[model samples]
Target: MSTKKNNPSALNEKAGISPPEIISSNAIQQIKESRKKQPSSQELIDGILAGNITALSRAITLIESTNSNHLTKANEVINGCLPHANQSIRIGITGVPGVGKSTFIEAFGKYLTSLGKKVAVLAVDPSSTISHGSILGDKTRMEELVKDKNAFIRPSASGETLGGVARKTRETITLCEAYGFDVILIETVGVGQSETAVHSMVDFFLLLKIAGAGDELQGIKRGIMEMADAIVINKADGDYIKKAQLTKVEFNRALHLFPPKKSGWIPTTATCSALTQEGIDGVWQTILDYLELVHSNHYFVEKRKEQNQFWMIETIDEQLKTHFYNQPNIIQLLESTKKAVQNNEISPFAAAQTLLDSYFKK
Candidate 1:
């Protein structure tokens, strides 16, 4: 006999992990019994309103999850939390990998905290999932800021479909707002900077650059420059200092070639050493001044409203694409259609029609 008086096995033992067949009533009951119930939406709302970071993180994860089952609960949480949101400024920042985006954010975030404001830093790091298999490294770069009490730092998960940003980053921003974060900083994967995905979502868009040859400017696309509300030349100390200033003048001239941004605010150029924390305050002041100008003109409110509408449509488009490819028959038909097109058995137009017809019929 076992020495334990209350042997778990003695009391109607069950397997630790259910087998496929056990996924019926027995497993259902076990799931019902063992499941850790999520906090009620009201409780989540209260927790967010009270500035509970754990609750804020959980809420964001719920919004980010692609599980169909959690969407209803996520929406409930959003609905309950909505009234408490929209209180913070959402800013988008992007730069190439070595341009000191993390350093800049850390310094800027600390400075904001000193001003009695809470800041949240979220980074999109899709590049991490390249063949190199590196981890998302933005949070690591901001080690000190990550540990700060007034800051919330989340690294965008690798290989996320939506530009490495969780599909719910926009929603997460609202959740952070409910938790009393006065500023929400969204950092994008520093790719070619044709990141309209990030640009479409934020009130203020900042592009970070390093002083370099004309080739560096060519590396970043012109489309992104048009979207930038400000451009900061990072690494503005040391040997790069003079070059950074020259780059600023170059950008200022370039900015003039395009019309003012949709909000009618002229983009400003500045230089800073994010590593040394020089001119960081000036960057923040530029952001604040831009906000003040836009807010007075009512463009701030309208911009967010338009972003919400854009997200709504974008979500629908994504879901439709997912649905199109996920249907079993549609996958088969799509492959066949591809081969047909490649072999010229069918015109591209006809092949597409056949695939769409099959998918819709299914």
Candidate 2:
């Protein structure tokens, strides 16, 4: 009886290696239970005010959800959080592809957290028009920063908005501020209208460039440079120091050509290596100097008020568009109108008028 009881359940050790559970079953059950108990808006608000990151993330999810009920709850949360926002500095960082944006943000974010500050990173990644999916590796690439307790890295909220920031980004920012983050970093990885949108909302705009051909004259991104509070050349350590200096001088010259900023602060250029963490602290110092000047004047308050008004108008426009597109009558008419225009049977403008008339019962 003793020998029989000692026998293994598999009966043979050489059959195969039994895979152990990588995650505990109890944890999975707990996750399911928590999902079933979806927190109320007021609970979410309280949790955010208390600096709970999990609650903050869930609140943002509600803001991004397309469901009508979710949107209503999201609006309530925003209104509640609004009173606590505008307490943190909003910074937008932009760079063209291959400029090491993710790596730079990681290094910069880590540096900020080391100063006993809470940092939040929101990346604007426009979804592929064809696939409706965004490249989400940006959050994962920030290995050290993501592990930092005071640093929060959020991947892009996927959708098409007017440009710059996503439609729900402002609400997300309010929630983050209420969660007690000192610095809000908006990373604009997408090209085009995104830059303008971000520039309108952020107190500081930074453009990151790599040391490359100076023949283009930095005029290629002239519009972005004009909006930049500062320009920093990255990858400046490994055999690129001299080239980086040259690029910085070129950017400084280009900056002088633009009209003065409303804040009356001249944009500065510098170089840093994200890998070596060189000059990262100086970048923060430059931002502090800007903050000091802007705060001493009326520009900072005026700019934020303007941004609120701008977003209010934008929200109205987005709602009108969404309402128009969601109507059954308009949806059916749009398909036929598109085919008519493509077949050259109707002028595009005339087709648009037809759709509008149908939408308004004209």
Candidate 3:
């Protein structure tokens, strides 16, 4: 055997083969460092309060997670953020399909950022039946706002939640506020009962409408109109401008017919063109004026208190229902009980009582 050390490059050159490239030691060290342990909950909290967008996004993801392992961490994060939250203005925006909600939100969010306001948009997209995942197309629709450094847009899946909002939306809002966003816009999945859920959480609820849609009032629920603090007619550019103007007048009249709001602020109507970004500021001004009016009368504080209580009760109800349905014994009994009720062997009320008794006894 030869005593000389083997030279891989010399051998490759003799064989007419190229030598393999090598990764630098620095790059190897960076890759190892990148795989370091994830930040603790306190680290996440500190980052969030320090206005770190990545931290904030991670915190919101935790809140939206259904993983049992994440529940405690998520709650701790929310608790840590609670003291820093609720300082921002929360606005709920809803509309019927084709009302251009994403377009308007982009325009409105851009306007707020232009005024040096840090804006956060929480858009709730309808979940797909097959995958049960959000399309998350709002960010694509809001091309301009997506590029704004001062703006944060999070699109969440409705995910079997009845109210056209993600189940964790309220918690997500808290995280955004803690991250120092001054203006938070929650975009619902169009107008319906989901609007009521959004109305309960937001300070000001805005409904977007369009013109020349035959009967504008036909599709919208009466309760939804009452929930609105303002109704905006979008797509007001060019040929639609006149139609939008007319619709605005009609909406103003319709608003007057509803009973006065407890906030003592009259809901107003305006038209805007999200395409041209016109009249966007007017809608924002209306919101600011309403905020001033409510804050002055102290209704703003009271309303938040009411919302807190409402969520508390709602949470209790949900938990109780979840607990009852999730019990092993209850799960075993449900099918048989349903059959009993179906076959007229037991009354529906009696069957329900049996299930409740089983749950309580356990």
The candidate maximizing lDDT is: 3
Candidate 1 weakest ten by summed lDDT = 125-134
Better TM-score candidate (1, 2): 2
- Candidate 3: residue pairs that collide: none
Q: Assess candidate 1 and give its TM-score to the true structure.
A: 0.84
CA RMSD of all predictions: 9.6, 5.5, 8.2
For each candidate, give its TM-score against the true structure. Answer: 0.84, 0.90, 0.88
Compose the digit string of candidate 1's lDDT tens values, residues 1-362. Answer: 67767647665648795546635788788789855777877778888888787788778878877787888888898888888888898889988777888889999999999999899998876644557344767778889998889999987663545666535777788788888889999998876432677777788999999897565556556788888899999989989898999888888888888876768799999999888989999999999999999999999999889988988898888778878888999877787789889999999999888888888787
Q: How would you encode candidate 2's per-residue C-alpha lDDT over 14-59 as one tens digit per residue?
A: 5667767688889999999978998999999999999888899999
Judged by lDDT against the true structure, how good is candidate 2?
Answer: 0.86
After superposing candidate 2 on the true structure, give the runs of residues whose Cα lies further than 4 Å from its correct spot: 1-31
Best by TM-score: 2
Runs in model 1 lying further than 4 Å from the true structure: 1-37, 127-134, 158-162, 192-194, 213-220
lDDT, model 3, position 255? 80
lDDT of 3 by residue, 1-362 (tens): 88999666743456656678998999999998975756779989999999888899888888888776887899899999999999999999998889899999998998899999999999988877798777799999999899999999999888776555634888888899989999999999873467888988999999998998998656456788889999899999999999999888878878878898889999899999999999998998899899999999999999999988987787677667777877899999999999999999999999999988888899
